[model samples]
Target: MKNEYTDHAWDERDPSPWLALYLDQSTPLPDEVKAAWLRDCSSSSRQFFLPLVRPMARVSMILIQLLKIFLPKRWSHSMLLHRLLALSMNRFVSPEANWLIMRHFHLGSQVLAFVAANAPVAVTATPLTPMVIDDVKDELFLRHDLNLFNFVIRLNKALRTENKELLPVPEPDFSMLRQPDLRLEDMPRGKLNLLDLQSAIEIYTPVYQLLLTDNDFWRASNSLQLDETVAIYCAKILASPEHLVLLNNKHPLVPMTTLYAAYRLVLHGLSSEMLHSLLMRMARGEIPVPARELAKMHKAAEAVAAEESLAP
Candidate 1:
């Protein structure tokens, strides 16, 4: 993979480049090239807002933990405390970043799928060692924060079943944005599970679903060796080779950090694409916005007739 592709993956530098692209308009956006901008918007928003609500999410975490002591682990999440916590997220959190919060699950799933199909059989055939699971779990939690390792196990079961149970997404209205529901549908999380069984899965690499138990999938999770192995396993599976190609020809060293980068990237890319598309429609009289508004878009679209000329 090229440096341009990896340049944006784990860094804070703005991938938006809206000003540059808007002013220049020379950069071509071929289908595959968009991976460079494929940030899962919802996840980024959640992380960004996390600092604001961590105190509460922390409280929720503690309450959930306390319930685990008295009840089955399965029952812990159903406690009033947990329900309130999930509800608070919709109430207090900013509505801006709702792209795909469980993107890691989907990405992780694809990584497993790729490894199962492409890696040597010994890996996919073997169950992950119980001893090693502790190490991988801690590391994955540190990086991805999928609630907790226990929660991830549950999330995985939900994610891979015949009827996929994607981690819940907050349903804040994004009606002002272009076809926000469609954007949600466009996300690749749940769809990535058992990808071959369905239509095209939105991964950077070609992936095939492999029949394997949960243990087989978690081993490449890089027991205490996550850094060295992230790229070897993830390389081009989650982030694309042409876009967010991983460092050292590898992918995320810190998966959640990479996840955040992706979230911002996706949000910016979507906004840019939407703005450009709307400008084009307006310029073509397919929309009713004024010529001045078209001009305001930095001439990203062609000139159009005045608003009065656009008759119904």
Candidate 2:
């Protein structure tokens, strides 16, 4: 009923300011990280977007054709306005199959909204177009990518199911902190003996589980140590295309990205909240390091490998 919340929708024509503020938090976001992320978004754009994007691009023209062919002569060309509004709203937030439905509704809403705004009261007794109107709404609803929507919806539901209180991180597992000899140079000198491998596993299980199921999760993987096997797997997944799917999964990319950001943060001895916003940014497509982070890690691994190879 009330249109007040519409401004907050992703379809807002000017999301730049919001996006900028959003990215600022993720800032100190390294250039290598930034470049890596842009590359990933670009690749995703090509793979998942371009195919169906064009049809929506020409939705207005298609709407004209539909109205001409299907509508009654007396109804003004504006009858399809409602569909346009609905579509635009849907497309802004939805992903996957439901996108088609949103596209159609956007074109149709323009006509319907126009009619609703301008149509005058009419006393004419001719039967009203009941079936046609219902069909339009029904079709839009049917075309919705319900599965994808449901998944996202369920994810948000799950997150909100609990309070906003932060989950307590367990003690670090000291026994598993043994850093391999090769990392002695590149990595800062630290007590490898202090890390709580088991605790880290418990804290990071959600992320590791997602990586296990993702096919591309290992593409960017770089093994660091036996104890960090899960972290390496996670790095692989984040660098892989599977990141996109996982981002859209039940836990959503928000938490996953946040976890990775936190892992990096922990290494820096930074506060966990340092990554809280960054995780939100990544979920909204501001992933830092992205593939490049994986590349860096890979390079580090290679450097270690090379050193090991030349060992006397």
Candidate 3:
């Protein structure tokens, strides 16, 4: 299992060894046990039922807009109203749904930040046009024309740079108005490496920073592994009167816990099984052993076993 752990550690750049453990077929569970475990762990049910809530969400949005007419603009945009609406929304949906929704927004913002930082010229040059969507289409039809435009512009610029080594004339399909799908057939025939796009998408420094600075985040992450020592440490931190008061006051637009889950999924491309396992552990509030402590224990046990064998 340990060998399997190291083998699959970087399979998804997942820091959690337990995730790798779950993925390793060498330690297969019985069908019934696996099914039960999956049932306990899975948030895919929220995804399954998400479409059903779209109409309700739309109605809620419309009602909120109508009510805004009676309320002052300041009141309508106030954090109080935002919190009320979020609380109401939370009542109707699972935590998974909230996580999924916020995750999308978080990822979209990350993409925009990436583009702004790496392709400033492309983002600045690209015209921001509003995308039209059919009202009858699914709620997922939400589009960001500006972001898409910037991405295409950047892609084309990269292609042009690559083209300098190849063809004299730029590909006719590469136009600002009509962005080709990022497919091999649609793209210009060249050594157009998407290293920039990859880098932009994979950047999780902000999320990492959040985890590093936050005791609650560490507590939550530790919960995934059900680590008693970390849990005790977290309890001591949380037991502080100042910390308890802060936690009571910490009402965020998006739950930091959900944000962490989403960040891990989006940034690391965590597999569905691993995600399910993580969500389950998080839900149960189990804190795992931190990797450092686990490594130390393993080394100590190995030394003790070696000494016993030498005595024999």
Best by lDDT: 3
RMSD of each: 20.8, 27.3, 25.2
User: What's the CA error at residue 222 for candidate 3, in Å?
Assistant: 39
lDDT of candidate model 3 versus the reference? 0.31
Candidate 3 at residue 158, lDDT? 66
Per-residue lDDT of 128-190 in model 1, one digit per residue for the tens? 211211223233322332222333344345445545432211221112222112233332333
Ranking by TM-score: 1, 3, 2
Candidate 2 local Cα displacement, residue 107, angstroms = 17
Q: Score every model by TM-score.
A: 0.28, 0.20, 0.23
Listed per model in order, the count of residue pairs whose N, CA or C atoms clash below 3 Å is 7, 34, 10
Question: What are the Cα lDDT values of the candidates?
Answer: 0.30, 0.30, 0.31
lDDT (Cα, tens digit) per residue for candidate 2, span 1-312: 122222435546666443343345334333322332223223444345544443443343244434445544443322243354333323332221122222223322221222122212211111112112233433233222232233234433544665331121121112211111221112112322122212222222233223222221221111111112222222332443332221211222222322232233222211111222233344355555365466677789999999999999
Residue 118, model 1, lDDT = 32
Compute the lDDT of residue 301 as modeled in candidate 3: 100
Error of 3 at 201 (Å): 22
Best by TM-score: 1
